[model samples]
Target: MPVAIPLTTHDLNSGGFAAARARTTARMTATVMDLTREIPNIRAYALRTWHEATQRLAEDPEATTAIRAERDRF
Candidate 1:
């Protein structure tokens, strides 16, 4: 679907509508594609952070104990 643009009758008659539609479509497509590319990197960062924390807590008795104690405070 083409992106919606506010156009007057004069603008439509002057072919400005086509130009505006094209620009809007291109901008929207670029934005969606950029987000598609970035989402995996975002997910990877979250997973990496989770794994690092998990490993640290597993390997450090004091950190594990502190985390458990903190959780118990709730």
Candidate 2:
């Protein structure tokens, strides 16, 4: 997917298209790297929360009824 950015004439005049493109690319690369670094942590958090939720449901006798009621509300 491509995104459009609105730049002023002055911005274009100062550094031109190449400079602007390089800057945008660098920022995007850094953002992707940051998210990549957090993959393991995010996965661990998701798994922990999922386990806790399932455990709670297992302990609650009325979990099925509650889930059905909640689903009907939507």
Best by lDDT: 1
> Which pairs clash inside model 2?
none
lDDT (C-alpha, whole model) for all candidates: 0.74, 0.74
Give me the overall lDDT of model 2.
0.74
Please provide, for model 2 over 1-74, each residue's C-alpha lDDT reduced to its tens digit, 9 standing for 90 to 100: 78988888877767567688889999999999999999999989777766666666567748886455444433
What TM-score would each prediction reach against the true structure?
A: 0.52, 0.65
Cα lDDT for residue 50, candidate 1: 65
- Model 2 residue 56 CA deviation (Å) reads 0.3
Worst 10 residues of 1 by lDDT: 65-74
For model 2, state the Cα shift of residue 72 in Å: 15
